[model samples]
Target: MEVELKLLLSPADNDKLLQHPLIAAHARAPVRTQQLSARYFDTPDLHLLRHGAGLRVRKIDGTWMQTMKAGGSVQSGLHRRNEWEGPVDRPWPRLGKLRKLIGDQQQWLDVLAADDLKARLEPLFVVAVERHTWDLDVDGNHIELVLDHGHIERHGRHVPINEVELELKDGDPASLFAFALRLQEQVPLRLSNTNKAERGYMLCRQTGTVPCRAQGLQLAPDATAADARLAILNNCLQHIQRNETAVIEGDDAETLHQMRVGVRRLRSALKLFEAAAPCPPALLEDIVWLGTELGAARDWDVLLASTLAHIQATPGGRSGVLDLQALALKAAHAKRSEAAQALLSQRYTRLLLTMGCWMQQPAPEGLEEPAQDFANRIMKRLHKKLLKRAQRMDESEPASIHRTRIAAKRARYALEFFHSLYGGKALRTYLKTLSSTQEQLGSHNDLVVADRLLRELNQQHDAAAATIQFARGYLQALQTSRTPDLGAIRAALHALRLP
Candidate 1:
């Protein structure tokens, strides 16, 4: 297994990193440089990619080496993957050698033998890099820091590479993050989940930004609460980091929304597992801070894209809707830009590093209890709390209803995190009902938020005051027209059985 953390850097930052005092002070040996050229291979249909594998043959210092990397998980730039490598005599991939490494792993054997796989394999793209490596022993932990500079080329097109990788040679994973965070103070570094082969594949296929989706969780039946909690957190971080590029560079609203969702899920997980695996109050506060930053931009996006559009299509709604939308959208776009910039900020980077380091440490005491037992206790309490809140939905004020929505959301997230343990047709039915009620409550809450934002817009911009006023009135009427069926929602909540 190969354990490493990959950080993206600009050309200037790369230079600054080399001269950084920490690198100079901690160097265990003189820096060594190597010129590496690797050619990735896959079937025309991307069979290996489909199986979560990558194959490449590289020439380094007049020797050929073939490497295969199998399934792995990446969280907050740290990659843990199964890798096999051996010297090769030819440039083409030696599938036989890779197959031998599989060593009677039935699944891999099947994949390797599928439909004349060897004959179908072809070179995809070439990655050439001048790598400068530094071996360091920081407080007894051995680490290898490498700076890779070059380009990935395919069909005469190329993309520059300026990345730093911190591979753990022999040490606790926490040390790697600590070192990376120290370097981040001197150089602008972005946590990157993309590997060289993935980049090469993207270039080969001319692929565009791919929005990330919530990953499914798979937990063993006898797993402990700590095991499940760590898995959930890892998945959340991966979703957030995987979509970072799309959120920042592709300007995709969905990607940004998914990233925000990831943060929310993490916060929810922290709360859900509090009894078993308590999180630091400071860490919780930091996560909430990040979520707020993401929410500000996403709230505006929902208002402009969905709420405003709906109003503009209604009767007497088009008169001033576009003007109001234009003004609000201008401000919303500014907020989104600010949010994007925050993702690249050192503060945010530190949060990721801190979270990664925390995850590597041991879980709190009670979390060693069986996962099902812990989940049952937690879910029952959440469901009861949600039911109590649901009872007052009709008579409660808007603030109360909003609180109900949040309760429902938390309960829903808890159910999702533990769904695999109690999965059944009944559980699915309960989830569907919960989802419906949650959506209605959420829509109501959105309207409440939108009203406040429109009022703020009216107060902030004198020129758009009249249009904003019109919007507020329209929004009020819309909110008045769509009364939530609280009775139905309450009944659904009552019907839910603890899974």
Candidate 2:
């Protein structure tokens, strides 16, 4: 297994990094520089990629080495993957050597033995870098820090790379992050999960930007609450960081929404595990602040795309629809820009470091209970709170219903986090019903928020007043048209038996 943390730096930061006092003070020997060229191989259809594996052969100095990396989890910037490497005499990959390591694993054997497998292997991309390596003893841990400057090339096209990898040679993995955080104070760095091979694969396939969804969690049956909480937090953080580029570089609404969802999920996890490992209030506030920044943009996007579209389709509402849409879109774009800037700010970087540090800390004493037991207690508590709020749904007040919606959402998120632990028809049914109820309540809440926003916009833009009035009326009508089926929601809530 190879464990390392990767951080990306701007090209300008490269020179400053070499002169930094920290680097000079910790160096055990003079920095060693070498040229490295690697060629990645895969089948025409990307068989290895689908199986979460990467194969590459590189020439360093005058020696050739082949490496195989597969199946691993990435949390923040840290990557822990199964890696096998050995020196070879030639430039071509020696797949048979890797095969020997796998023994008789049938699945792997079948893929390795596919007809023309060796023949089909083609050079996907070339990574050529000038690597600078330093061996440092940080707090008694042996750490190897390597800085690579080069490009990933494919068919004459290339993407520049200026990144640092801190591999743990010996001792605690936590030290890697600690060193990273300290180094971050002098140089701006972003946590990067995109490995060299992944960038090559993307370039080879000419892949475009796409929204990142949450990856499923795989937990053991006997995992403890602390274990589950850490896994859930890691999953949420990955979702947020994975979509960072798409959210900032591309104007993809879904990506922004997913990013916001990731933030919400992280906040929810913090609350869910509060009893076991309470997050600092300051950290919680920062998370909330970032979420609000993201939400401002996302809320407008929903109104412009969905709610406004619905209003435009209604009679008498189409008169000023175009004008209103133009104004809303302008505002939405501005908010998105603001949200993107927030992501790039130093505050956001510090927040990531804070959360990373918190994650490495030991769980509180009380969190050692089995996950199943913890899930049962937490689920029942959240469900009861949700039910109590639902009981007041008959009031039909916007504020009251909004509160219910929030409760439902929290309960639903809790269910989702623990669903894998207790999977059955009942859990599925409960989730389905909860989803339906949450959607209905969410729509109602959107109307309430939309009306308020329209009123505010109406005050600012005299030309949009008529359009805002029309929108408010349409939203009220829509809200009245679809009442939430509270009775059915209650029935589902009651039917759920805590596992």
Question: How accurate locally, in lDDT, is each candidate?
Answer: 0.85, 0.85
Candidate 1 lDDT over residue span 356-392, tens digit each: 8888887778788898988898888888899998887
Candidate 2, after superposition: displacement of residue 473 in Å? 3.7
Question: Which segments of candidate 2 are over 4 A away from where they belong?
Answer: 100-111, 394-396, 480-499
For model 2, residues 417-481, the per-residue Cα lDDT tens digits are 88888787878777787788788778877777788778878988997777788778878888788
The local lDDT score (0 to 100) that residue 21 gets in candidate 1 is 89
Worst 10 residues of 2 by lDDT: 490-499
